[model samples]
Target: MKIFRILQIMSLIGVLIPMGCSDFLEKKSQDEVIVTTVSDFDEFLLGSGYVTYVQYANLYFLDDDIEYYESEYYDELSDVMASYGFQSWQPDMWESEEVIRTNWETYTSTYSRIMGVNAVLDGIDKARGEIEARDQVKAEALALRGYYYFMLVNTFGEPYNYNKKALGVPLKLSADIEENGMPRNTVEEVYMQIVEDLRESSALFEKYPKRRGNYRINLPTVNILLSRVYLHMERWDSVIVAANKAIQYSEGLTDYTKFSGSNFFMCSYDHSEVEWIYGVGVNIQFFGPSADLLSRYDKNDCRPGMWFDMGEYSTNRLLKKDYDWMSGSATPVNTVRISEAYLNRAEAYVQKGMTGEALADLNEVRCNRITGYTNIENVPANLLEEVRLERRLELCFDEQRWFDLRRYGMPSITHRYRYRKSDPWVIYTLREKDPLYTLPLPNEAIRNNVRLEQNASAYEPKRSGVEE
Candidate 1:
């Protein structure tokens, strides 16, 4: 977990800031771009644009070790799952002191990247060349801007579907900078702008052939992101359309056969069929977990099996046939799969008053779980509730359950257990949030940005070493 933190923190400054956030809106065209007049702003598209870089600064990287162990921290900084090898964090997990703070810091990079995009957006209005290519640049710049805003809004602001029109990061659309000490914009305004950016990004990126290579953005990734944003806003129609479009370009549904293959566990961003779009590579590793969480599963499960199993029903550690006492490096695969699209569609359908259609999508995902079960024809009328629960169980250990629970606006579930690895089992809460339900921005960020204010409830303990 400490290693993950080192990587995330390092990238915030080393990777994103130093690199100049160019990739955030870089163009791939080989043709030399030529600018003519302000009317030739499209020509600026030919000029070197900033590349888009997605820094996957993880939760474990954001907070100290203790927060990583607990799925929920009473105070956000106190407990987090990144310590146990989960890179993802929930927005509602506002209490993960660093989650909010580091994510806020992550903005330094994202917003910095946006400046590059905005520079192009501002500059291109005059220089011009291929009208279509120029148009594509315009679209990409807008989309890139939207993508960053989405990340910032999701992390710092409230969900679009919910309340409040007050305060979010400053809306810096152009690169020509002025005041660095801008407060936030209203959440309502941010969402509206975000909607415009994504819609435009989707349109622009779609003009080009899909981008491939380990970490580049392309048409499909934009679709996947738009779908996610729509989900947050509860725009069911847009979510369904975007997800389905993304799935069209998707490859395979599962790599169960190769799941534990060489370097599969920590290798970051593998080529799995279900991945519609992914950015920022990160390796995965297992570390701290309070023991009791392990007690629920069979002893053989790699994650749940690390500890002793009570085995009220069985004695031996039950290993999944696929794991095969796996050893050595295992690559990490972190992308929303086609399975996720099905899940998203299920929710959209449920909202659209199409329970039967929703159930079909839900079952499609359930039927494929490594721990498979029959998809029931009689899915409950409360399909949303069932979807929420399935998301928790199905997505557990995927760095997702924590966020899923928080996004659904439910108090997350918890349990207690001891550290059984080197000693006996102990008790601890697996999940919980405190104060305003969000962790304070990290102390470092609070001190860095004058415009940035600390959430009163947020504060993490001083750490002696890297988070273990």
Candidate 2:
């Protein structure tokens, strides 16, 4: 009860900056704490700061999904947009303080969630509650913690296949805050922790009541996260197993043909296709779908109309209708959907040489998105490529494309930007396996914790034709 109350106060003050000094961690509020009962613990889990959505604005700039055009308001560009634009235009932009701070904020916010999770796990056992209620609370905390760590490692560390020995974000396991510096764990160690936590969470979910919405983690969500983890680890058979388990519970997909105009702005909160929802709102005024990305969509594919708006001059901007109009937040941006499970299974089947099974799964999702949908009879020579294309089409602008590119062998990315209507387009390229692909740790983080080493390939300033 005391720990939960402490966590409640800490959550309010945003004091859970991980590995901070003991004095900061020990500070407590005098306000009457409410986390004395099982229900109170549940409320703590649902607290605003603890269960917040992730913002994708920073990651969006790094991917090839968006394009930049000079606005009439400025022959030049605004500072905010200019900062992000340079990141897209110049490979060395990661060295900039602005870019480093943006990335650092995401890292700090994710670990803050982990801190809250550890608080619940540490106190749940002592609460006077029904056995089932305690287990359910603990399960949710484990899942949430694992989910945060998964995001951190993927963003800050090298892809699993690239090097298991590569450094990952610090792995924090306890509620008792440590003032001392913590070393980065290897990618393999971090991944193993994620798997262990999720696997335990799955077992605990059997004791918890079935949750109604995609907003909260449940049995199906656990399996879905597991499927994703397996996919990243390249455990083909496990991917199929986990995906199948998730599909058994939630298999609904929105029928695009039956739907009417502009469903693109619909968040997962209202969208039937979503299986789990967790993404923050983003402003895409200057960033729109790339010409190349728009080209990938078939004319008949309903997704283009539903997901993007081709305004005057055929400029493609993501539809904001699905987002919270009043608050400008988008629901389910960082979610796992039923379609993703099928995609996961399909990809796994392909890796396992079960081309027929893979194609069947692929067709399941394609039929729902394309008009006059028909199943493919013969597998294409590039079966994996075809599946990957569907993933890009299905999951674009949702913060998956950037990570997908990295995991898929760090493919070359080229972005074409035009400063003015009269200016010829200038192309910027990120070569395959470029050091910039793995962003450097924030300068402040390295300074605060001596144990935290800077990435080998820290950003170096390079002049590009685009004005900063």
Candidate 3:
């Protein structure tokens, strides 16, 4: 990598202040920010190592759960114009005329945070602190790095189960800035790293076992992440084991029946069900539920009424804003909750031919979220489908839908968009097993590293016209 690229990584974590290209080359590599205290590492991680929900906003648009409603001035609005490629599933999503698009923000943001985490992991061992405190810092960094890789691999690479041999994101395990860009790892290799980091995290947690707030990583959070990863890998027994541990350690589920107001139901970070509160608040005002997703909710389910604005065309709006939307601050959303552990176990049970156990898990979530809920005594014939439906309903808009869609065989999906009120709808279809399922490496990445190969184009050349 060039000095500029190395500077990008260093500057992202506030470690470098290179004045000019020529001047930076003369300075010693060790002349950078010096953070040598346990307190310094903790603050550094919190400030630069964390990712906001905005980093995942693009994925939310790609999932089938969202329905894009275009206005008459669609082409005039900058946001709508910029999002057109992603909303329509175009391969040139990050290289469009509407925006100066050269890179995927999600890709850059995630890798940047991973670099920050790497910084902490690189030097925290020698930091001045108690052994247990250093262990806590190390555990959090390991878990966070694993989680970041999980996001990157899922977004920029093919699904692990679909093709573990497929190309994945580069594994940057060290804080040392590279003079040459690294090659992409195999999907299997990336997943191996993720599992290793999480295992280390789990071991460190066992040593310290400290409870930060739900906003931070804990033992339960690590287990939940493991269960999710194993679920994607189709390791059913591993999912059951990890999810069971998460459930045992979690604070327990929040009963929807207890709250009549949907506004504050899941708005607080301190909610009982939350495992780790992370991610920036998404502007739900820009999107709404897809008809397919909306139909999955039962009439007796309390979520729809509480979670959505049920007025005319309210299906185009998500009513559940973040806890601090009333204020002018970003609300950190929870990526893992107690309900997910139940759902994970349920799906694992169904795969393992334990229909009764799966149904019990479904009932556990349904009973808490559904009003006038009736416990089904008998296992349904389509037990796996039932578990999947429940999982979708419970984890919708929480950044799981897109990945779920990918692991579920990358099903065909269609999005309809119109440029104006008078114009007919333009149909955009992502056919089953389409290469579009795996996003291409960001152009900036490929430019920086000739060793990196971009994924296949997502565009379907034959299917871009307006439907009459």
Which of the numbered candidates is closest to the native, going by highest lDDT?
Answer: 3
Task: Please say which candidate is ahead in TM-score: 1 or 3.
Answer: 3
Candidate 3 C-alpha error for residue 422, in Å:
4.0
TM-score of each: 0.62, 0.86, 0.89
Ranked candidates, highest lDDT first: 3, 2, 1
Q: What shift in Å separates residue 136 of candidate 2 from its native position after superposition? A: 2.8
Instruction: Encode model 3's per-residue lDDT on 1-468: one tens digit a residue.
Output: 112133456674334333443221333254444565778677677766776546766676787888765422434555556667777777777666653442236676677788878878888888888888888889999999999999999998999999999999999998776666788999999999999999899888877544847367888889889999999999999999989888887778888877775455465655788767776656544467778888988887788776665556432355443434546666575456878999999999999999889889999899998888999999989888888988888888877888999999999988876655576877787889788788766676677677777787644353374584
Of 2 and 3, the candidate ranking higher by lDDT? 3
Q: Which candidate is the best by TM-score?
A: 3
How far is each candidate from the true structure, as Cα RMSD in Å? 10.0, 4.7, 4.6
- Model 3 clash pairs? 1-179, 1-180, 52-280, 53-279, 53-280
Q: Please give the TM-score that candidate 1 achieves against the real structure.
A: 0.62
Per-residue lDDT of model 1, residues 1-468, tens digit only: 000121132233333322243332232233222234433333222222233322444432322121122222133222133222122222233334443443424556666566656656765545435666566667756766777787666555544454446355678776443435556787678877887887777776676665543433456656766776677778899889988887776663553433443233321235444343333223222223324333333232232332222234322222211122235322223344455666777788888888998898777665544343556878686788877655543334433443344356625333322222333333222234422233334444444557876654344332112212
**What TM-score does structure 3 among the candidates reach?**
0.89
Query: Cα lDDT of all candidates, in order?
Result: 0.48, 0.70, 0.75
